[model samples]
Target: MTPWTTLLVPDILRRICEYQRGIYEDVVPFRRFLSNGATVHGTSKQAQAFESVLSPWLALYPSISRLVASYEPIKHALACHCAYTGRAGILQHLHKRYILQSVAVNLCQMAIAGQRLDVLEYLVCIGYELPRQFESVYLSWKDQAVFDFVFEHYRPLCTTNTTIYAFASSGNEDALMRLLSYVDEAQIRLMWSVAASHGHVELARTIYTASVDISDHVYQFAGSSFFSTTFQHIKNAANVGSIDGMFWIYDIANPFFSQEDRIAVVGFCLKYAVMENLWDRVWTLLEQADGRVDYPQLLACLPYFKWPQDESNARSMLSSTPALIPMFCTSWLPTIKDQAKRRLLEEELMSMAVLYHDGDRLEAREWLGDVDEYYFNAMEWLMDEYCIDKSIAHDVFQGPLGVAAMKRAIENDHIATMRLLLKYGVQIVPEYIFRRGGIRAIKFYLDKVNPEFTIPVDLLVEMASTPTNDTVFQIVHRTWRARTSITIVHTVESQCIAQAEAHGQVNIIIYLAKSFQSVHSPSEYETFLIQHVQDFYCAFNRARHGVNQLFAIWNPVLDACFNVEFILESLDSLLALTEENLKRLVSLSFVHIPTELIVQCALTNSVLAWRVFCILLDAKIKDKSSRMELQRECLVKKYEGRKFRNVPTVDGLGF
Candidate 1:
């Protein structure tokens, strides 16, 4: 084989290995094929290829061992693939080729991981010893048959309680029963711990029945159990809303748990119960606690209550605890007839909303219905209480609560809240609306504004600086034209063109230029037009430099900063003018045309090169050195067209 083809052999093998291992998610074999009615790690075709193709092919050469020795990871990976895919033929071939003493353990581990009893047997047949104290191997199999095979033939020693725990947790009853005969009392309790934590109640009952001298009370098992297994099962069950499992474990393990453990368990259960909207469970747990709880701790849990799912239930829950109603719950606010209590709930709800900027939470309670004024009162309370503690002040708000809320709505992209705020006559800073609210918010605001109100020309120009909805510019121009003169319109379009050029908004410049062309003759705005085109050429040069600095990162920020070739193609309509028009514009501006632009223009379209490069010469923008280089490059191009006489020199040409 050629050297290049030979060098690619390892990489090719690795890719094949990856394919067998299902590393490529988009590949056909991995997604479509299944093994034993489950998603396959390796397809049958992969196994056949390993056995029929790769194994026999490698066997023909003694250099196969050298290749395996050179790339050790690939060798191990190949071995793993063989064991995992149950390709015993290739595995035997690999053993015959390269069986290093150190690699035997890894091969055995992979065999066990393969969950194939035959592969394990083959490794032993090849004189490889299985590791002593095989807890990991025991933990590996969820299949009962594999465990049974290991027990019948191999029976590797067990050192820790981990094997039984894994068996119990995996719900392998047959494996756990077989394992129960071997372990002592400590390991037996550990098995019970796993069963209790995982809610394997029948398995726990089986262990209690099978084991001798075990008490009916679970505290006997709990004392020697893992600490996390003891206390955490309660929280785990509570978190998953497994009330039966939680209470069963609680009733069993109650004697062993400390006061702190009980508090943590109750707190965690109460919090999730509230969030899960388990009202019956919440009331029952609260009644069982019977004022043993810290009121402040329970009050803290009230804020997280799932108010949206059952608002009436939440109201009743809050009303049952009247003091917390004044603190956290907002559902009761709509029903509270007392003015003082209504104000208190309103202040608390809005304070939480403003502090968290949680629009969904605030919206859930319908607190914004007639409470427009209360939003500011809430902001004040936040400033005095919450903000003051953090050394923050009222300056966080732009103006009134409604305007602040409107800004928050814009930031969070909450359109409904924005409309509601606007409907309530919340005045907003027009620039902030244009900048942050984007086109949709701008349209909403414009639709709500009085007919006489037009967005300020300066703000419109600012918006035009970046790419925004073209419809906004059209609307502003259409509205502003009726009140203003053609001269003022020309000036507005000119400033917009300048802003668009400065920010490299090629499309916007084209749009504004087309709009300007419709209104007036080109000659009337010749100076302004020339300056705008010059600014574009300069901006393009900066964009090229900016692109070199920030490589491979693409986003809107990058587009705004470093828009390149697409800008050239997009601006063709505005820039592809006649030669004389281009020359006159370039000459009037007095800025140097970039030589790179000339070269790119030549390459992009040779016809447009004449129009663009002629301006470079006529404007005296091409310096003597650049002129010589361009001439020399042209001479070389010209000479290369035929049998060359001699290589051209810059000095040979007349200066």
Candidate 2:
């Protein structure tokens, strides 16, 4: 036979055994599979190759068995597997070798946990001492057969109270009854406490029945304060939807609770009843309390209640208390989205207000402050439904009330409400409307409310500068059209043109430029156009120096000047300028053009480049000199060399 060294050295085998032992400790199912039959089939390719390498080594090195037997992890795993799988043969072999001593108690626990009576008996026959808390483990199992066997064979390891409490808490009726033969009244009361606290209603009832005096235990359980085991049990019962358990403690067990406890109990029941939509139960509890409970305290609890499934019952419960109308209006009405339900709530509120105020509008209006949103809703409701006089409705919208209502209406974009307030002689500032009412509301005011209203020039300029909507520009245009005096047109035209140029509104700039040209002479038009181009160039350069280079590119006035047709026409108007003014315009226009773009154009299209160069040359001729002509010739020759070099060669022949 081949020696184990041929397969692997002893050190390598020892390391492999150590790794397997570590795995055996943490992985129970894998340990069970190893003990059953350490077989590997249809595994991954890597696992198959690993097995092919390790199997021969493991077989040859039977010293691994002695190592495993002595190893703590392997001993534990074997004990657990034998106890769990009822493999007494393995347990007997391990015990004969004294390898099961380390895991004897754990093996007993596993046997009890798995209810393996045969393994337990074998473990006992092998002189395995049971743990002191073995009965605790036995009670947890709640298997009567195992408990009986453990009780008859093993000495009592746990007290009767611990046993009874465990049985009661586990809701094991048969095991609890079997243990009941040994429990006295105190233990029974303890069992009742545990059973009730754990939501074991039937077991609790049985224990309570077996107790001598239920009231003593109940009082002892409740202690001196409301935050006691009794209260906790009741609340837990309610939370778990165990109505019988909750009522058994509240009604049957302790009927004569204190006034505070009664109020608390009724409040809890009422809250649950309302949440569950138990209308009859809610009314019954309320009547039984008979005004003993604080209604506001009860009403405060209503918000914690869920929206009931049957909303009609919820409405009935709410309407049953007329004094809570304000609470409902302020607290609950806003959350309701259904129009019909809201209308129903409003009708209830209106009826309650009428009944309480005895048809006195001033009294009800005083009861509901004018600044409150609910008051406005009530006033609107009264005017619409009760046919209250418009003069009376108008009375509420005076002073602070009027301003508050108008502000809210504007904020909510309620145009109809604003119109209503205005009809009632409520004066509003146009500036306030412009500031808060946005462009639509501003337009509404201009077109419908007051056409003569004028926004300040500074504000109009600001609005034009960052015009979120084009309609603002249209509104400013309308204002300009309405008053076309020379000064007004010039001011409006200059502001609009500056803003349009700043925002890269080329189309708007073109339109304004045409308008300005139509109203002014050619010289005035040329002067204003140059001023606009200069302003745009200054703003663009300032933006380029800041973090707004992208804005600079988008708002480049040179691009606008080239793209806008009306701008070209305006530039044509400048064709008859003085020599100095032409030079200035040509310099300003070329200053903003990127040099790289000019070079690319000069190389790719020499004709266009020459045309631009000739234009510049003509503009510079006011102080014509030989130096200027020589410099222009040098620039032309430089571009010509670049253009010729860019031409492709076809078969060594330039194309």
* TM-score of each predicted structure versus truth: 0.37, 0.37
Model 2, range 1-655, lDDT digits (tens) per residue?
Answer: 1333422454554654556645334322233433422221211222223343344424332453554543554455445655755667767766776657654446776576556888888888777766665445343455666677777676354335666666766787776655555655556656665676567888778867755453345434344653454577677777777765676666543555666666666776676666665668777776666434455656765675454344455455443444444544555655778877666556555444322233333222222222334333554655565443566545555666567657666655566656767877777786666555656566668888877765666666565566345555556566646755555767776886677557655445555666676767977876676567654443433332221222222233444365322222232222333344334445654333333333333343445444443454454444657535544444564545465645433223211
Predictions in order: lDDT = 0.53, 0.54
- The positional error of residue 620 in candidate 2, measured at the CA in angstroms, is 99
lDDT tens readout by residue for model 1, 36-74 = 232223432354444433453344344445445444444
Give the top-scoring candidate (TM-score): 1
**Candidate 1 residue-wise lDDT at 317:** 47
Error of 2 at 563 (Å): 99
Candidate of highest lDDT: 2
TM-score of 2: 0.37
**What lDDT does model 1 reach?**
0.53
